[model samples]
Target: MRAALAALLLAMPAAAQTGDLVATDALRVCADPANLPFSNDRGEGFENRIATLLARALDRKLDYVFFPQVQGFVRNTLRAGRCDLVMGTVAGDELMQNTNPYYHTTYVIAYRRDRPVPERLDDPAMKSLRLGAIARTPPIDLLLRNGLIGNARFFPLAVDTRHESPGADLMQAVADGELDAALVWGPIAGYQAKVKGLPIALRALPTEAGVARMDFFITMGIRAQEPEWRRRINTAIRDHQGEIDAILRDYGVPLLDAEGRLQPP
Candidate 1:
């Protein structure tokens, strides 16, 4: 009886540890429910696809936490423990532990094909040229800091579409002569421009501001103390880079090479 009891006590901890690693308990992802080309409740977006791939690689199942992406996404979803991971995080966001980036998208200067591309927003010829850009995106911030606001014309937000996706319309608005040029998010802007066959050229600024490197990237994020989770995510990103690229490509997202030009394949 004593010998049997000792074996049972030894087995309990091992069993408990094993139980803790089940698929359903392993992955918990946070995403905005209505954000498209990124994530949503239906799991049809690129981020959702990538999350599924990551979960599959980790041999786990995903559980999602949906929330609005306003000011509270990080605090409400990440900090509140609604999920374990935050997809598509910007570099240096203070709240979470960000992993090494697996990919990058360029910040391009998009303009009508017939119009000469401005050498820089500060160029003299660009002074009277009207431009459209999202409110707080990197390029917009750069233009503001350089005092390029004279020619900058803010596009009025369509009250209903602002939350769902403001990029598509913003790009279309530029193509329709609603604005001369648009400083927009790379993927959405490029994808829409390509889809519309709008004879617009995407030019990499001679020197991009805000991010010091041309190879600016974004990464997956985990809770700050969860080093183990971070390691797992980073390993998955490194190991499954090819798969990641394929997913991005399927969405028409232009992934840039080290030179900041779009990769051929």
Candidate 2:
């Protein structure tokens, strides 16, 4: 029976095998080709810079299997064997085993410097503002629970960000006086505000009673079968801490410490 099982396992597809999935010649990355601040075909995003660091540390050529970050992204890229790693994923996501978290961030509400928003989502002031939040993200729940969704605008997620940056656009709306405030992911809001020089201000959403999580730890994703590879990459992350932090800093990512305080430049 042991011999039969060994033979059966060996006959199964390579991806199903419990083995080191790291490629010998390259760091094959699964990335969205047009997702700015995260990745793109032009290799211009922070994840691309991190991918280069990882490839160098592993002594492998960097290669990317470009795909849009749409439904079935993992199924089409990593699990389909087009690549061996995803550069960024929310830690604890059920779809992939995660590496040690590299960064912590939170949702932030952005508005024009002159237009103030309620610090807490449950504030009664929220109900009066013309707010915008992504349709399916955490803010929507808070927006609804506080009865603030009446005048709130909902933007769709998973668009080709190269063509449509809903988060940045919403921030722009705030700066242009089209909207009162917009709650969005921190990195996008910070990066866009800096790069675009929008007259917008951002405030991190603190943890609140009876509210959904506003913060997340981000990690690289690996196949559940690739524990060894995960360790190797984790070591790479430790070895390149300064470079990684600098890359994120360059991209204007809003980083938070374990206690949820913002990191200063």
lDDT of 1 by residue, 1-265 (tens): 9999999999876555423322345588988887666877899778999999999998887899888777767888877876888899877778877988977886667787887666677677676777877665566666766677766766544333326467766777777877778876666766665544676767664345454343358898777765556677889999999999988887766678887677753
- Per-prediction count of colliding residue pairs? 0, 0
- Model 2's alpha-carbon lDDT is 0.84
Full-model lDDT for every candidate: 0.73, 0.84
Candidate 2 regions exceeding 4 Å error are 1-21
Best by TM-score: 2
Q: Candidate 2 vs. truth: CA RMSD?
A: 4.4
Model 1 TM-score (2 dp): 0.79
